[model samples]
Target: MNLYQQAEYWLSAHKIDQLPEDEGIEVAFAGRSNAGKSSAINVITAQRSLARTSKTPGRTQQIIFFKLDESRRLVDLPGYGFAKVPLAVKQHWQKTLERYLQTRRSLRGLILMMDVRHPLTEFDQEMLNWCKLSNMPVHILLTKADKLSRGKGSAALEQVRSELSGEMSVQLFSALKRVGVDEARKRLNEWFQITG
Candidate 1:
């Protein structure tokens, strides 16, 4: 299926306390600030503005939810590891993210976007830790693949694989170039089918 064409805006929850009832499959998108999480969502949904893109860091503070044909939900979580953001806000996101990662059974998987230039930051490691503890399947997308040459992308991918000790799948992606979009979509679509 063409995932982009099937997505629709469903809901946005600022706090975990306000999240809707656990309904269908939820695949969360997370990464450090400026990691292209929002842009990736926009590309996957084929909606230019469905997920807000920002040059500034720490703008997305909510766990936004978008429905995919009523069978699965794509979540855009706030960017973590914004050193300039207030400590309170960081703490809040951390608590919420950790809790959601640890407890949400409906969360079928996680799409962890990372800038190819800086594949795995300390915060990325922490997020991986949470995924490990939860035993959640994760897919790491090295965003901005177009920024690097083909050889560079391959080397970066290898670097990340060697550095991260986990079971998550990895792919090099470029939202601008539409690279790896199909692979990411296929994985998410499979979760939708399983949940449906």
Candidate 2:
């Protein structure tokens, strides 16, 4: 908790060159628009507004970094899919995302957030495939678990697990219910400790 609580806004990179120096390890959080990405980050970090939640989707238009210390950081990537933005803006973000993911040596892992009701969207699959190709570690967070009954939530988890069998770690989560916060934090800690 101490490490996450120490997270403070570092910088926002609209272009690849605007990013911090590629040195310390960082874990990126990514999800489709409206997938509760901000809520999950705030909950994991124990900060109410660390990632900036919004009723309107696609408010995070750039890669925002939250520094946990000198050698650690949490990156909030721009949400993709259904952002209601102009085509040129979306194109720029797509290009930026591709370049970062492929070239960021300091990026240790990715925490992929997906809404429980909508587990694997087209965009999510593309991310998974890209990670697989690059041999990047990924952890999936099925956010908004509190919106479903216990049985339903478990079922959704199982289905996703079965589909992606033997690939990556996954768990149910809910920012509002405080579900799986510890588990998520543990994963983050493990990744941070790793040299990547």
Top lDDT model: 2
On TM-score, the candidate that comes out on top is 2
lDDT of 1 at 140: 92
Clashing pairs in 2: none
Clashing pairs in 1: none
Question: What C-alpha lDDT, on a 0 to 100 scale, does residue 191 get in candidate 2?
Answer: 84
In order, candidate lDDTs are: 0.85, 0.90
lDDT of 2 by residue, 18-121 (tens): 99999989999998988888888898888999899998999788899999999999999989896578999999999999999999999999999999998899
Q: Please, what is the TM-score per model?
A: 0.92, 0.96
Question: Model 2 misses residue 171 by how many Å?
Answer: 0.3
Query: How much lDDT does candidate 2 score?
Result: 0.90
